[model samples]
Every structure is written in structure tokens, then in C-alpha cells.
Target: MSTVALVTGATQGLGLALVEGLAQRLEPEDTVYLTGRDLDRVGAAVAAMPAGGAQVRGELLDVADPTAAERLAAQLKSRHGGVDVVFGNAVMRVGPDDDPRRIVRDYVEVNNFGTTRLLRAFAPILRDNARLIIVASSLGTLHHLAPSLHDRFDGPGSLDDLDHQVARWRDAVADGSARSGDWPGFVNIPSKIAQVAAVRILAADRRESDSARGILLAAVCPGMINTPTSALWWNVSDAPTPAQAANGLVDLALGPVDPAHYGELVRGGKVLPWSPASGRATVVPYAATTASS
Candidate 1:
């Protein structure tokens, strides 16, 4: 039996990279579902693939839009009986004046909510040993971004970080230390802490799932991958190619799960430390305000 997988935000960055890698690793009997908002790019991606002998196709899905999730669910139900793997990879970022709050909200909506939508829609079809993976950032790790005194905080702390960052910006603007236009706030350590917390929540959700067995789910740090998404980074050209990151993700997708690896953030295909406790994930300082929204 071939394993079928679905990936969102599939036109570029980590999403597209994973699609390509899956094409190589999975069999022709297997199917890979690729999704994005741009229909043309989706078409182009399908046309450009090297015949993996596997059934590879693309679907247009703007994960942030609730309707799109419904449409996608119907389509999946009609076509593939169910999916063996689902990679909740889509995410969107916004600026100060953007709707629905900060970029973190958008990220959570697409990365977190969008992912859950896919799983819920396909719950009936998910195989006994299916895998569910959510791509998450290191910024969400509380230990790395929150004050050491706040070590006791966990999932809720992640949401609080967003509130804290916004408050900090208000204070900064009032003090004449920051600009007033930075509404809903600036990127700070707290935002990162929240993001990591979101990832942990995702892992926990899968761990408690009774629907699948030997299910492997994790949040990975692709490690400074160079793509159009991060073009502003000065060393983008020097950074590892998206293909490199995709390859690493493929390794993770195919690897066996050790209890120790669950809820872990990986770099260079190995889990890394996020705090002094070791083997924890760390977040790089905020660079793109766009990354935080």
C-alpha cells in the first residue's frame, strides 16, 4: 500500500520543498496533495515535477479563508479516500494595520487552525498509522524568549506573549522610544515564546489522538533556509537553499519517532536545545517585523 500525503502553502518555501522531496521518497501508488492560493503557481508546480510515478497534484487553498478549508475537504473526500500524512504547512504574515491583529494571529490561524481543519475534515479517512506533522518556528519556545522567571508558563503563556508584546509597544510609543504607527505592536521575545507554545500544543494534540497509531508529529526549524519569503535577509543568497531544508524535512518525515523527539524542534536533521536545560529549541531574534506582524 502506498502512503498518501497532503501539504499546504505548497507553491513556495518549505511547503513546495516538502512536496518535491515527497515526490522522490514516496511511491507512484502514493499520492501527494499540494495546496496554495495561486492557481497558476500550483499548476506550474505540478507540471514541473519529475515523474515520481506517484500521483502528484495541486489544489488552490488559502488556508486563512474558512471556506477554502471546506472546499478542500469536499475535494479530498471525493478524490482520495483519505490521507496517510498531512503536513499543516501554510502560514500568512501581516503588518501593523493588518486585520485580525498581528502576524502571529494570522500564523496561528493558518498554521494552527488551518492544520486542524485539514485533520478534522479528513479524520474519517486517516489511516491507522497515518502521520500528522505541523511545521512550527523556534520563536514560539517560551524558554528561549520568555524571562527565566516565567519558566513555569506553558501553552497559555504563548498567547500571553502576544499580549505582552503589544503592551510593550504601547509603552515604547508613550516613552518616545518607538514609533506610534507600530500598532498591535512590534516583534519581541514574547511573540517567539508564543509561537513555540503553539507548536507544543500541536504536538500534544496529536499525542492524545486515538485515531492513529505510531503517528509521528513534530515541529521543525528548517534552519535559515533561503527563499523568496525571507529575501530581505542580507545573507539570503548565502543561506542554505530551500532544497536543502526540504531534504531535511523529508528526513524527519521518514524517520522513526522516539518519545524524546516528540514536541522537539530540529536543526540540521537533529533536535537542538531551546534553553539551558538542553535539547530545547531556540528562536533567533526578531528580524522581519513581517514575521511577527
Candidate 2:
């Protein structure tokens, strides 16, 4: 049977680039699904890809909708039997003037909750040895958070414990006290932190179940990609392009699975130490990490 790969948020930016990159490496009989919240954009993206190789199809998916993932899983099972690779790349960014409570809620809804939901819904539909890549960010490193909060994420916290921690942050936002609490003012970092931790939890669960042995699960940071989203938040133009950033993500999704690569934070094709023995430190720039692809 031919291999199948699925990429979420493939309308544009890094997600779209990942789909194209994967398609380039696929055999003629293989298939790649390009998905996004908007059907129009998804269609356009699929139409734009070069033809005559791996089959490319557009799928409409909204990660924020609680029911969307379940529906997608059913469709995948019916059509493809199971997925060989899945790129969980959909994300949401807060806007200025958005209420603090709404910001925290929205970020968690899409970035954390949506990602977990996709993983859970697809676990049964993922073939053994399947590659699951959660697109994360280096900014989500533990060093960016308060000491106590960082400890919670770095240690042996159950999925329930992680949910409890997120609830506390939501409470702080609702009460207008997030700035004074351990929760960071920016929601993106914490959301990514939750994503990375969730990967570890899910990997452990998969191992215990013994249903998906050899499944490679990892969270990868694309670094500072020069996309519309990054431009909205920063005043930088020297970052890597979306296609360049997608290289590391696509490599992890398509590369050979190794025991050392599972449940780790990969940046620019290199695995980062989650808890450094010395102390917490920030991520280096993309240019300094590895050669562009």
C-alpha cells in the first residue's frame, strides 16, 4: 500500500510548505492531504501544487471546532484505512484589544486543546510506526516561564495535571490578574509549552497501550519564520522564510524514526535538551543552528 500524509493548516505559510515538501518525496501512488479551515483556500493550495506525482487532495478542517477532528478521523479511516504521517500545524494568535480571558481561552482552544483532540481522535487511525509531528516554538521553552510553573512542565505531570495548570491560567486571565501571577502575559508561549508536554504524555500512553509501537511522536520548533503572523508580532525581517522553516518540520515528519527522536523538542533538525543540567537558556537563532534546506 502507498503511504499517506496529512497536514493541517495547509492553506499557506509553513503548513503549506510542509505539504509540498512531503509531496516531492512521495511515490506516485502515495497521497498527501492539504487541509485548512477554509475550503476555498485549501482548494487553491491543492490546485497550485505540481501535478503528476503523489496524489494531492484538499480537506476542510477547523481545529478549533470540537467535532471537526472526530469527523476527519472517520473520513480518513473510511478512505485511507490509516495515516502514515500527520503534521499538527494549525495555530491561533491573539489580537490587540482582545480581552485577557478571551485570549487565553482562544489560544488554549486551538493550540493546546485542538492538538490534543486531533491526537486522541487519530490514535486509533494512525498506523503503527506512524510519524506525528506537532509544530511547536522555541519561545515555549521552560526558561520563559516562572520557576514554579516551569518545574510543573518539566517534571512528571499527568495530562490531568497539565489541564489543571491551564485552568489556573484561565482563572488568572478572567480575574485580570495574569500579569501578577505565574502565568505569562503572552498566551502563545504557554500554549506551545502545553503542546510539547502533551506530546510526552501521549508518547508514554502509546507505549503503555502497545498498540502503536514504533510510532514517532515529537514537537518541533520552526524558529523565527518570516511569515505574516511573525510580522504582526515582531519588527524583524531577517528570519527564515516559511519554506525554510518547514524544512525541519517536514524532515521530522518524513525522516527515519529513531528511539532518541521520540518525545523530544527538535529545532532545526536537532534535538534540544528539555531540562538542561546547568540552567535554563533561550534558543539560538535559526541561521546559527543548521544549514537551510
Candidate 3:
């Protein structure tokens, strides 16, 4: 059987570059599903691949649609039985100057909630030893959220528990008290924070429920890539090209799986300092050390 993989938001930017790199390493008969919201763009992106070993196919997917993730999961399961690799790279970027309400809406609807939908739909269908990679950013630090809410994400919780945290954030936004509630003034920080935290929560669940599967899950920060979307936030002239930033992701998938990086946000082989410690998730010092001090 062929190695099966799926890359969401694969039409352009980091997603496109990941597809390009992963294709180069696959053996003949390897199947890749590169997806995006627009069928035209998806076709063009797949058609424009560098003619690597894998058979590249275009798929139409908008991660934000409530039913889209589950529907796609069912189709893939029926056709391939299961998938070996999954790149959750779909995202919506926002400018800080955008309307406060709109910024909140875009961040929650597309960046944050979209990820949750994918996790729910795909987690069960992952093949043994499969790697589930989420293209998160370096900005996902717990320091951005209030210390009071840190426990909601850091330890022992179901998906429902983590989701309630996001609900509280949305509720705070609705009432104009997000900033007062110790949420970051800028919306992107909390969104990314939640993204990585979700990875940790899901990883823990997988370990507890089905320890034999060897499903490697992680959130990777590709760093500042030189792309139009990245240009919106900072100068991209000196940033690494998308192909360059994608190397880590491709390597993580093709290379050996190191359990240390699993369930953490890794950049350039080092776990981001703020991500929880080995086998535990938390941005702050461990409880025992804090209590003893």
C-alpha cells in the first residue's frame, strides 16, 4: 500500500512549500492530498509541483467550515483506510489595526477554532507511527494569557475542558473585557497559545487511551518565513523563504520520531522554552518547586 498524507491550506506559503519538500522524499505510489478553499488554486498548486516521486492530488477544503473536517476525514478513511501524515497548516492572519471585533472573530473562527475542528475529526484516524504536525507560530506562549487560567490548559483535561477555556476567551471578547481579563492585548498571541496547548492536551489523551498506536503529534513553529502573509506582520526581506522554513517540518515527518518534541512546539530542533516540560504541559515553574520555594 502507498503512504498516504494530507496537507491542508496547501495552495501557497508554508503549506505549499511543505508539499513541495515532502514530495521530493516520497517513494513511487505515495499519495498526497494538497487542499485549499478554492478549487482553481488547489488545481494550480498541484499542477505546479516539481514532479517529485509522489502522486500529488488537489482537494478542496476550508478548515473553518463546521462539517468540512469530518466530511473529509470520512472520505479519506473510506478510500485509504487511514493516513500516515497530516499537516494542519490552514490559518487566517490578521493585522493589529483591524477592528477589535473583527480581529477577535477572524482569530477565533479560522485560526483557533479551525484547528480544534481538525483535531476532533482526524485524531482517531491517524495510522500507527503517523506524525500529526500542526503549523503553529513561535508566538504561542502561555505568558500571554493570565496566570489564573494557566491550569485550564497545562494539565489533566479532556478536549471539553480545553474548549471551555476558548469559550471564556470569546465571552470576554464579546463584552470588551478581554484585555482586562489578562488576555493579551493583541489577539494572535492567545490564538497561537491555544493552538499549541491543544496539541499537548490531545497528545496526553492519546497516550492514556491508546498507548500502543505510536501516533506522534506535535506543533511546529516554522519561524519568520518570507511570505506575503508574514509580510503583513513584519519585514520579510531578511526572513527565510517558505521552502527554507519548511525543511524542519519535512525533516520532522521523514526523520526519526523523537518523543521529546512530541506534543510541544518545536523550532529548529529545540522545544520553545515556554512549552511545558517533558511529559508535562505548563508555561510556569512546576508546582512542587513553586510550593517549596
Candidate 4:
């Protein structure tokens, strides 16, 4: 059977680099699906890839749209039977001036909820030993949150618990109490934290369903890369190139499933400690700001 891989948000940056890296590693009979929100961008990305051994195809996917995700899953099932690897690389950033409620809702919709949607749509069809790589961020580390929040995220919680925790954060942001409640007013970090927590929950669920499949699910931080998105938040002139950062993501997706890496947050190909003890020594509190009516 030919190996099949799917990469989300593959139009450019780390996502595109991951697609190129996966293509180079795949066999001639293998296939890599490059997906993005825009058909033209996806098509252009596919066209730009070197005609390597693997067959590259473009597909339009808007992770925030559940219907789009479901449609893609159905198509993948019909054409490939199952997927061997999935790189959940799509992400959104919130601006300082954006409404707190909108920030939280939009980020959760795409980064956290959208990720779960994909996992749900593909879980049944993922091949045994399939790899699910979530492109997370170090900014989402537990160290940034209060000890109480850390416990809730790292503790043994069901998927429902995770959802409830995220929903509470959303409510806090909407009510203008996020800063006082220790919830980050911005979405980037909190969304990534939720993504990591969700991965842990999903891994446990997957294991209960089939322990022997060796299905590896992990969230990884591709150290600060000079992507357009990063440029919006920070000066990236000194940051690593997208290809350099993508190396770890591609490795985690295609490399052997190190039992240690399962359900862990990896960076620079190393698993960082996720426990409360490993959290940063100082927690920066979010400043209180009134949301515009």
C-alpha cells in the first residue's frame, strides 16, 4: 500500500516546507496532499514543489470550517482508504487591537476546535501506526500560566474537561475578566496551550481504543521561524528559516515513534518537560484592558 500524507496550511512557511520535506522522504508510489484555505495558493504551492518521487496534490481546506474538514476527510477515505500522516499546521494570530472576544473565539475555532474536528473526522480512518503531528508553539508552555491553570491543563482530564476549560477561558475573555482570571487576553499562547492539552486528551482516548496500533500523537513547537505570521508579532531577522524549523516537524511526522515523544511537546527534536514543575519560574500576569463595546 502506498503511504499517504496530509499537510494543512501548506501554502507557505513551515507548512510548505514540511510538504517538501515529506515529499523528499516518501517513496515513488506515495502521495502527499497539500492543503490551504485558498485553491490558488494550494495549487501554486503544489506546482512549486520539485517533481520528486512522491505524487503531490493540492486540496482546498479551511480548518476553521468543519464542513470543509469533513469533506476533505471523506475524499481522503474514498481515494486513499486511510492516511498515514497528518500535519496539523494551520494557525491564526490575534492582533493587539482586535476585540478580546473575537480573538478568543477565532483562535479557538481554528487552533483548538478545528484541530479536534480534524482528529474526529480522521480518527476512524487513520491507518494503524499513523502519525499525527500538531504544530504547536513554545509560547504556549505551561510555565506561562498560573499554577492552578497548569494543574487543570496537565491533570488527567477527559476531552469534555478540556473543552470546558477552553470554554471558560473564552467566557472570561468575552466578559473582560480574562486578565484578572489569569487567562491570557490574547489567543496565540492560550490557543496553543489548549492545542497541547487537547493532544494529551486525544492520545489517551486513542490508546484506549487500540493500544497496539502504536499511533503517535504529539504537539511540537517549531522554534521561532521567519514566517510571515511570525513577522507580524516579532522581528524575525534573527529567527531560523522556515525550512530549518520545519526539519523537526517533518522528522516527528515521519520518524520512528519514540515512546517518549507520544503526547509530548517537542522542540528542536527534544521533548520539553510539560509538568507544572517544568513551568517557568515566573508567571507574567495579563494586564486588565476593557474590551470595546
Candidate 2 structure lDDT = 0.77
- Choose 3 or 4, whichever is better by TM-score: 4
State the weakest 10-residue window (summed lDDT) of model 4. Answer: 284-293
Candidate lDDT scores, in order, read: 0.61, 0.77, 0.78, 0.79
Q: Quick one: how many clashes does candidate 3 have?
A: 0
lDDT by residue (193-287, candidate 2, tens digit) is 88888888777777644333677888888888887767866764999888877777777777776677678778876777665455754433222
- Candidate 3 global TM-score: 0.88
Worst 10 contiguous positions by lDDT, candidate 3: 284-293
| Candidate numbers, best lDDT first, in rank order | 4, 3, 2, 1
After superposition, candidate 2 runs with Cα above 4 Å error: 95-99, 151-161, 208-212, 279-293
The candidate that wins on TM-score is 4
* Best lDDT among the predictions, by candidate number: 4
| TM-score (C-alpha) between model 1 and the true structure | 0.72
Tens-place lDDT per residue, model 3, 249-275, is 999987877778878898998888654
Give the clashing residue pairs of candidate 3, or none.
none
Please give the RMSD to the true structure for each candidate, in Å: 5.8, 5.8, 6.3, 2.6
Instruction: Give residue 211's lDDT in candidate 4 (0 to 100).
Output: 50
Residue 25 in candidate 2, Cα distance off native in Å = 1.2
Clashing residue pairs for model 2: none
Global Cα lDDT for candidate 3: 0.78
